[model samples]
Target chain A: MALFSSLTPVFIAIICVLIGVILKKTNGEKEKRETKSKPLSRPWVDEDLKDGTDHHLEEEDVDEEWQGLDENVAHVPFFAERYSEGEMIKRSQMFYELLNKRRSVRFLSDEPVPREVIDNVIRTAGTSPSGAHTEPWTFVVVQDPYLKHKIREIVEEEEEINYKKRMGDRWVNDLKRLRTNWIKEYLDTAPYLILIFKQVYGWLPNGKKKTHYYNEISVSIACGILLAALQNAGLYTVTSTPLNCGPQLRVLLQRPANEKLLLLLPVGYPKKEATVPALTRKPLEDIMVVM
Target chain B: MALFSSLTPVFIAIICVLIGVILKKTNGEKEKRETKSKPLSRPWVDEDLKDGTDHHLEEEDVDEEWQGLDENVAHVPFFAERYSEGEMIKRSQMFYELLNKRRSVRFLSDEPVPREVIDNVIRTAGTSPSGAHTEPWTFVVVQDPYLKHKIREIVEEEEEINYKKRMGDRWVNDLKRLRTNWIKEYLDTAPYLILIFKQVYGWLPNGKKKTHYYNEISVSIACGILLAALQNAGLYTVTSTPLNCGPQLRVLLQRPANEKLLLLLPVGYPKKEATVPALTRKPLEDIMVVM
Candidate 1:
């Protein structure tokens, strides 16, 4: 018994050392996980911004079968309205001139835009292509002054944190030339605040979650079309991705859990004194490779 | 010395267990990193794709100062063209009608399109707004039949693997209704195959890597504008992300390592017998909510 008690001290010391090593390893693992989830390079990106695979991973225990169309749908013949080459050239050049005039105007006028125009442009965005025709987008058009202010508060609050704390010196320095800070007066001044939400997943008729593949890319493409529509209609807005404000905005708008905010555009006419950074686009040769 | 010898066996046993635990933890860490890098739910997404953070991680030892515009650029007064309310409504409706007519046409005609139109449409795409004014996009207009055919071969080979093996039964079954298969004859049939690449990062004048934030979303938006320009000029094309063909096509087209293929568009006239699935967009009310 005396010998065993003598050995207990050494055994306890070894156990203590082993436990310490294990504790350090576990702490390292947790730090690694945190870093993995929040990439250091792009700290401004919201944690909620993902490609819906996270949701899919959670629901993996449920239905493994894809609940898309049960049977093949019929295809109808498509006849395009073909324009003459000369006409095509003219139209293309004219369209380019019109769109080339587009600038991301941060200062918006409170002038009431035609609600019909906003409706038409949102409708135009709805026509964008999706992965397997899964149209996973929701357009929340907030015109109520109270809701607009609420959104502005949420955006400015998060953006202040982004600029001051989350976004490091490099990102802040990168945007120094653009003169963009957390102040978004346009959010309150614009006639409409069009907040776009990408539906990560949709419910099947049987109450199962159906994965919407490429939802972010799909919705962004649709937003592209929406931008064109807005420009074509002579509307002005800035395409802003509010950092870290997605979940709050999603909840503020009462959007379902499956929906995440992708973009927020305050649509209206530019304030008469609106100014944009004198930025030049890369020439066609610089941007295009003809091979 | 006699007592130490007696305890040696127990010490060795404890050491063995400690070593085993360490090995298991390390293995677990490696497995976790692998899973994090390649999310299982969206396995078909190319592994190369990332928001420029991977490159940033690699270059951590380099200069950390952002090499964007050193001096703040001047802001210029912006004046948008104002259209009458009636004109605005009419324009918005007309634009929607034109864009709504667009369908993803897989079957393309080999008829030569006006290269000027292609240039202008791309120019319009170039005018897209990007993060921090970093126009990170390359539109490779491939008209050469040989190169086009080479692209077709690469796409088809990858697509065959994707459809046959890479994509499991659920994905394949999901796409069964769309009638899409590994066969992509449009790669050869289209007069021009516009491969859009997002420049993930760019080299500064001082040879340091400049991060291009939101490059994927920016390029996709440019593509949206490109699609709109094509439609306005009565051109027909389909928006396709040829799965798993990004790296090969990038090398095939001689693009730089910093660029990754985002979308592949076959632009030309549609085949006479081009048929589209009778898909209807969600109505404005279904897609939009007013608050």
Candidate 2:
């Protein structure tokens, strides 16, 4: 009890210090000019930060009844204005509903999904944030019979090797429920294959290979978005990272040396006789803690 | 046209070849005694190699039957006999809806989020799939006042330094849209601060650190699940890396050195008057391509 009481003051001091520190880091850079006053008022009070007028969300609030205010962030455009209150709620809710229906489709139907819809869904994925905003990802849509065949050939070859030599007995044992094997009929059966690539670093306009910030994290987030958007757009997706096709896929796609193959997707409708593994989700109590 | 027509047969042959190879590998290890076919008559012929069992998810059936004939998968315990149609639709739809609302929130409200809620969410995050099933993340929940303050201070100091010195002009300029400065008040205003540590590897059952499989990717996916769950539970969150609090956080928390700070999250209810930056999503056409 005594030890705990003594540590109380130190703890309080730490919390105050942290709060001050974060405000300084997140706000200080924005108000470099005002060293004398609190940075908070400078941006929040400035009419410009309330989303000064440039956006395409179809909202009608940009007409200025007032005059000139300083643009606090010269580089950053005003937070995308033009989104209305009702629209925001609607869009947010709609997105949630759409995302709810997504599934990993292992069994696929031969029914064709429209290319335009797929393209639109992908467009949504591309909007995700990336390291340095490099947006370093390539979406390859494979529909050609020969190309998919080659991909299947490559993937199956590697999988067979992994099952036999690379993976241990324990791993093979662990995979007993996944129902996966080298024969990926979906690779050919699906109407489309979206191969994703991640670029570690990127080429600049001046021919320099600029370093990317948090490349792996950025790519992972974007990949998640891509998967989600496909589901939202009424498509089934399974994220597959084949063990040994890194070299073969790179060469086959004629991709740049800096880019690496991350996943192979067979996107389409589920077969009439499709079924998913009867997996039970952990109850909210097991998964969540409410304070 | 003639070249394309001739290639179709070649493609079909290639798929067959892949199938042959995969079957060869799978059967190579199957025990001879187990290779005998079942004599019982069934409607489903099941032409393909049965890599795993299917507890059929029939829409007509309300309860999913567990036959208990299959192998085990982490976080999946059902050896289901049959899945109901409603179950499949519910699962698929749930995935879709949850996925769409998923967003990385940087802007946050200071209103306190319950510790129990955060804990529950972290537990849920733990349910995600890990590479080789080696769970490689540690969750450190810090609610102590002084510790929170200290974290804020250190984070701000590093961020300020990053903006002024390390980050180039272009990089800083690019971040302009975010209007992010070093000040992170949400760290304090929020009720709970959850620090996620990525364990590179940990001691095995025998006291040796075991090798982790694609540990980074696995942990990230878990984070994704946690984020989804938190949102579903009606809580707001802000994900941050802050600046240089990584080492300090580990020290402050007295964690094993193998763990490195991955993300610092401030969870709570959105402030009553709080507003998120208005951002626009890219149109659907820009992202997807179906060949």
lDDT by residue for model 2 (B1-291), tens: 656544545555555555555554444443231222220111011211110111111111212222222465433222112224344344445544444443445555554544545555665566554544456677677777788888888888878877776554555655555566778887777667777766654454444434444455556556555555555556556666554557776787787666667767776666555554444444444333334
Residue-by-residue lDDT tens digits, candidate 1, A1-291: 768856765776677567757766776797676457445555545677755235545545545576856656788999999889999999999999999999999999999999999999999999898887889999999999999999999999989988998877777898988889999998899999999999977888888877677778889999999999999999998889998899999999999998989899999999889999888889999999999
lDDT of 2 at B60: 17
Which prediction has the highest lDDT against the true structure?
1
Model 1 regions more than 4 Å off = A1-9, A12-38, A52-59, B1-30, B33-38, B52-56, B59-62
- Candidate closest to the true structure, highest DockQ: 1
- Per-residue lDDT tens digits of candidate 2, residues A107-143? 7667776655655545545655554345666777888
**Residue ranges of candidate 2 with Cα displaced over 4 Å:** A1-105, A168-170, A230-235, A269-291, B1-107, B113-144, B160-181, B199-211, B224-238, B242-244, B254-258, B268-290
Report the CA-based lDDT of candidate 1 relative to the real structure.
0.85
The ten-residue window of minimal lDDT in model 2 chain A covers A47-56
